[model samples]
Target chain A: MKKIIQFIVLAFVLLPGVARAQEAAGSINDMWSFPVVYAYDEEVTWFFDLSTTTFAAESDVYLWIWSPSEPDAGNWENSSEFAKLTYEGDMIWSFTLTPTEYFNMTPEDIAASAGFWFRLKDLTGSLQSEVHSMAYTDYSSFAGSGELWRSYPSSPLIDEGVSILFNANLAEGFEDATSIHFHSGLNFWDIAVEYQSWIPEVVEKTQLKNMGGGIYKMDLIPQEYYEAPDGYVMENIAFLFVKDDWAGTTADQVLYAGEFIPPPPPVFTFFPQQISKKDFLGIIRTNNEPGINTLIYTVTAGTVEVTGEITGGVSEIKGFVNLVSALQNVDVTEIHVLVKDNTDRTISDTTIPLKQLD
Target chain B: MRSKIIYGLAIMGLIAVGCNDPDDGSYVDPVTIYEKMDGDWGLMSLNMVDEYAKANAIEPSEQNMGAYFNYEDFKIRFSVDDNMEPTTYEVMGDVPPLFPANGYWKLSSAFQQPNGEAVKIYLYSDAQKTQMTDELKLVAVPGSGEQMELQLVRKSGGIAFVSYSFKLNAVN
Candidate 1:
């Protein structure tokens, strides 16, 4: 009779017509609730909606935004550039920009759509830009150099920040009626981006006896390529995507995907788990778990046990280095370790150099 | 094509007239100012040296410079405006000398104070040096035409050359 009741309940819960009962749990995963709405991965760090990042010599787009809040204010004026920074998103940009002078601001918190108003300049020499609002785009790790097991000497230091760009179209492309939405949950909200523009230089020419008017080319390093300023380390930051005109598209269609790096192995910390003093041997073992490391002790008078393992892997290495007679009566010092890669390549061999600190 | 000169005459003041030194006054030649400034006027004349000298903080020497020189494709000029009148000179045919990035200069004139002291004022453009006021004058030429040496009494001096970029923009 009890089994019959259970079978009936199971069948009812699995029925296609029956609605699945969602559990009213107290906690909801942040990722599950707040999600990335849209993105375009073909660009560097700039994500857009009415911005100066859209500047190009031949491209018919030239307008910049300086609204720190109110993403839709689209206030395109050239005076009183004070209220021009955005601090809603957890980011900052500091540098000198055009027409306007400095790009300096420190952000203390994050909020929805910046409350700043922007003045749009007509660089296209065409129509005026009537931008409604802009959403920030996030870039993940911009694949740089780093080490795992060994702390490499920081001869040259490292740091990080991002450049966000946008396109100011000859005409506003995305609208509320057909508003383009981005899905990158990691997108920038408050931006401090100060885009640059190009000016025309007048050149003169003289007729050379044998040479024609020659061509001159100059090589310059873009500011974006500059190493981060001193004293900071960026975590694998990189380009996320663009949405210069992503509108009315499905969440998947607007998404700009980022490549994820598998998390590094957890570092296993060792505590001298146990030590047994036998007549001729000193046995020692530490908690041998994921990402854990180990070393061997020097029994000035006896033999000792030592082991090393691959982090997050099943490879186990157990061995012993014989302490010779020359070491007899030698104080049994502490153990040290050397971590190796799968190919037996030694990565870290730090001698946790010990001392008798009574 | 019609010749065009981008003459940049930044003269700041009108100078007083009459030479207190009666001997020097009679010898003063009015035609020389206009004659020396002409070379096809702008393509290669006095304006170039004046512009370059003012910008570079060095006056033109007779042989070493203030001579016809080649530049980013075209030719250049040289000149010294009078101290008695506020004059705006004509432009040359080629590209005029840009105020070099080093110092600055402007055109000015001659003067004689109530005291009988003959004072010839020339504009000084170097920010590193004190701005020569209406009281200072162009030092009399050490020598004359062909060997003519133009030096500033307290206002200007030195040989103008392309690489003579001393007294760079102080703000820089």
Candidate 2:
């Protein structure tokens, strides 16, 4: 008698569900929500109205939310449950998307889209609704709305070991910007040549000082690649601003430090522009260059070539170069001088006019 | 027609060659040593021959030289007239020379030598120019064309020669 009573109750409870599962067929008519203007990590509820044919009014419903990036049912990014409906007046099935649910989305996805698309299904998983997308225009406005407060120095002319100032102001979703990094190398022309294969040659972390109001200032001293062998020639450097808390990043772009200039072109002035047959003093004045230990110069005129070295300082080299043998043969001669720094960098090339004095 | 084309090419080559002027914007006016050296000069300092002997480190003897030359009480003046003739006046202790201490000087970029070519400034004691007091090799320090230094080299044959240096400033 006890088993019969339990079977009757069970059959009665499941009989209606079985019948409803076979007969009940309805399409999700529309999904409606309100109060689109909300801050990040704010929870909101969505209402779904279903047009039923033969389903009971007290059936259970489930809500499935998805990121627009991957909207397939197998890969439904997220899901939420709607409370049981007890009120008989309005057959409105509603789902509450908690703040934790919204925060679970990836930063990249939240930055890209205002709201996610969702689908509705019953507990049996037999009947499903079509996929629909919704966006909170007010809330979505804050997504991906990051912009640079001030323009970086456009092609600033800088020297090696000089302090370069960098300032940026972030607003909206970029409020958490904690650090700024400067990525250099891969010049303007190299980017085109390497195409997508370009990577930063050097990355330097700049120290930042907060000036409130989302404004950050830093003095970046680029030690690496400052004295590059080829030297900097108006090459473009990229600065990346990152919010480490959420792993948010600003797109990489060129700072255009104007041009990386090398020491002034090797220049020299020679005394006695007019050298007589008797050996006269010639002072070759070379501009001081960094790391220059010796100045190797070649004096070439007509067919005579004499190579000499200045060991002490590159600033000035004074001595009597034995040009008597070289110039005694010609009436009026032109002496070509080629000078190079210790690094074998050509500093200057000039010619001196000499005449045999009577 | 072929000859006409050849003539056109020849004319173009000649035009290109004529446009190649290496002396463009490189003209430097050459100033002779006589022009730059014609100024009033005063001796500033002197490098004593050997201070080691004055320190009482060496024994007293006549061979120990006290000093080579002293110019504290004497100021020499050089004058170059428009005729290019040079004259000198030696003043001793605010008193002018009693006998018109006149001398002649010459500046030349070359004096025939085997190896080194140097600017030689010759100072003769008389108008007839029989005696010479000094023959200095003037080398303008690199970068400062206005200043000239004459190294007070010693009389030793070897490495002791190039030790002393004297500076001459242009006061005029």
> Which digits, one per residue and each the tens of the lDDT, describe model 2 over residues B8-79?
999999999999878667676554455555665555543322222333343210111112123333344556
The top-ranked prediction according to TM-score is: 2
Candidate 2, residue B78: Cα displacement in angstroms equals 23
Judge the docking of candidate 2 as incorrect, acceptable, medium or high.
incorrect
Range of the 10 consecutive residues with the lowest summed lDDT in candidate 1 chain A = A202-211
**Worst window of 10 by summed lDDT in candidate 1 chain B:** B163-172
- Residues A28-61, candidate 2: write the lDDT tens digits: 5655542223333445555666654233455766
Per-candidate RMSD, Å: 36.8, 31.5
My TM-score estimates for the predictions, one after another, are: 0.15, 0.29
Q: What overall lDDT goes with each candidate model?
A: 0.27, 0.48
Pick the lDDT winner.
Answer: 2
- Worst window of 10 by summed lDDT in candidate 2 chain B: B60-69
Error of 1 at A313 (Å): 7.9
All candidates: interface RMSD: 40.6, 18.7
Model 2 misplaced stretches (Cα beyond 4 Å): A1-182, A185-221, A224-266, A281-283, A301-303, A312-320, A325-332, A345-351, B1-172
| Candidate 2 chain A worst ten-residue window by lDDT | A192-201
